[model samples]
Target: MDQAPGSPQGPQDAPSLPKCYRHPDRDTGISCTRCERPICTECMISASVGFQCPECVRTGSGTGHAPDANRPRTIAGGSITDDSFLVTKILIGINVAVFVMVLALGERFLAETELIGYAYSPQLSEIVGVAHGQWYRLVTAVFLHQELPHILFNMLGLWFLGRIVEPALGRSRFIAVYLLSGLGGSALAYLLAAPNQPSLGASGAIFGLMGAFAVLARRTNIDMRPVLIILAVSLVLTFTRPDISWEGHIGGLVAGALITLGLVYAPRDRRTLVQLATCAAVLLLILATVVGRTVSLT
Candidate 1:
């Protein structure tokens, strides 16, 4: 039985209860401090100031009151921000841009961009030269790709490997490993390939990443069978493929392994110094090898 409106009754009807804003059916005595709206316990969020409703929490986040755990942290003395594989993305962008430029320039420009042996021809001055001023080819050749498939495969490999390696090593060291590995590949190619032979691609750097992965895995005592198997398959392909530069592949692999070894095995004390020294030593060795090989050619 209900009481008539504005009529005195034997028993007054209970007052209507407040409902949660989010869950309207849910009756609640609690209300949000900011909005003063009724809210259920489930809608409550812990806050430094006090308990807040979800809406208030979201508003606080927009005002920089919330801590975002997902944000990337700085590493390597803040030299690299672990802020979403930025170095890897930049590398990919540069590679793609260069590829586009090469396509626009045509086959003649593409041939000129190749890492040709110094002894091959005086006609293509852009070809990498050990004795000439075109030594930049050691690094530049890694960015050049001859075909669509070539860049596609190499970029895919880089995307896969860079995501893993860059995060582990941070941006600066990862870049160092990449450039050194590429230089190593070019160095060996210069030393071993026929003076007339021309080769270009990022396969060397990719192989270097594989080698680094293997070394890091081994040092960490992680099962390395998969890495080793992949490495073996790559080595087999390098040897069997008539067009592949086995010298570059092997050189890059060795360089990557050595660099990672230094990084992994460095003593806890003066660790950064040791790693830097190790990289410096590797670079000097590669430079010496290039100089010696060039003198021999002369």
Candidate 2:
């Protein structure tokens, strides 16, 4: 089995502003305080601390009884779904399913999915890795976990962080942060770790969430002490713990912070464009890193 893939032995794994709800053609970061939905400056009804959507202003209050067309939105302009944590839950399910498969299918299963720059796979009598054009491994490895504890910790962390981060950033923005963070982690590991060293896990994505949550908390003026303590410990573990991919963790942290910074702080005037540019730039950076590393290894 690919037991400790990213270690000396193992592998581990790890958008846009929204359009204005009423005027979908427009893009704005300023959401209605009452409806919590995106609204253009024209639709903004000045209220305390923030603006209210036209409907909320007309209604005189948010009754939470708006029709489905008037679904509430998140602070980041994502529609507030029935379950704010839907995406988070789905991610956990995916990780768990992949973990179960890894257990059932054994090392070959892991070798096929885990992030490796370039490595030989004995089971298939062939070389396999991102360098070999198996770039999907960069993503698959993130959901692949061979050990129980690894998945457990990651899932728990996802739930804990998702509850807050997902709702605030909205579902689409949340997904963007997560996926880019995971890729950043994988790309960094590919660049820095040994070519043949395989690693896989959700740690990168989780760390990304940690970085994001920190930013969100700060933006909302929530006490930072609690998040800081947790982050401090995680950082300590990333460095001190053996078999943990510190490169992936750090990459994720940086990616998450950068991505979320754009999402939250972007000017309402051009929030969508800025956010799209941020994601594109970060993805290009990661891809460039991977390409350079692959060239050197080959």
Candidate 3:
């Protein structure tokens, strides 16, 4: 119980200082709040509860911790994954599948699938209306292309534009824009082209994506020269080429631009609501145009 002067004390007689786990030689009074490992100030990161070691911070990040605003975020506010372009892939798949079906089923099938009759053709009587109520032709025609070259060009456009636009707009909004733009094209063709003329292909939707891309670029204040050039070339092709559906291209461009305008310009406080309303209104306008054309033809 008694010690002589200058004699070493027993282990229990003196308090032990903790050393940093990372730097064993360095004495650190601090311990990680999560892992409880001793860490020096240099190895510690401030956490909500207390200081955490670098290893614990990394581990927590891997386990679903929320990222800061500057990091890339998915539609659900999670980390970006490999399937960011899933919707675009699915659209391309559907278009390819339908083209295959057209090849297998022959000309009759292609004729039936494309948007036809009063709106699409010139010779058909307005009063006759769409045979067997094939109202879906307005949408389905977008996926049907007759020639190899036609499908190739459209799919290439989709692949290029989809990759750029899909990630920016998210899955739902991108798909909505594509489908609605296709419908808008069909409606325009019905109103402008010969009543009996049949039209098919994804050009309308592709053009729509182009338009959306232009709007997005403008919103972000990027250079518009490239977009403007592409658009001008496409418009020239539409007008100069007798076979091209100029009406469809113009309609889709307008529709896509309007929809993207609403999405990009929405107020931060009610972004989702405003975006949905904007897209819905564009779709309704397309539907109304189709109905009005149908009545005129009748």
lDDT of 1 by residue, 227-261 (tens): 78888998998999788999899999999889888
TM-scores, one per candidate: 0.71, 0.78, 0.72
What would the C-alpha RMSD of candidate 2 be, to one decimal place? Answer: 14.3
Q: lDDT of candidate 3 vs native?
A: 0.75
Model 3 clash pairs are 120-197, 121-194, 121-195, 121-196, 121-197, 122-194, 122-195, 122-196, 122-197
Q: After superposition, how far is residue 50 of candidate 3 from its true place, in Å?
A: 37
**lDDT against the true structure, each candidate:** 0.74, 0.83, 0.75
Worst 10 residues of 3 by lDDT: 70-79
Residue pairs that clash (backbone atoms under 3 angstroms), model 1? none
Q: lDDT per residue, candidate 3, 179-280, as tens digits?
A: 988888888887788777788889989899989988866754446898899999988888998889888998888888888888766765686888889888
Greater lDDT among 1 and 2 belongs to 2
- Highest-scoring model, lDDT: 2
- Point out the worst 10-residue segment of candidate 1 by lDDT: 71-80
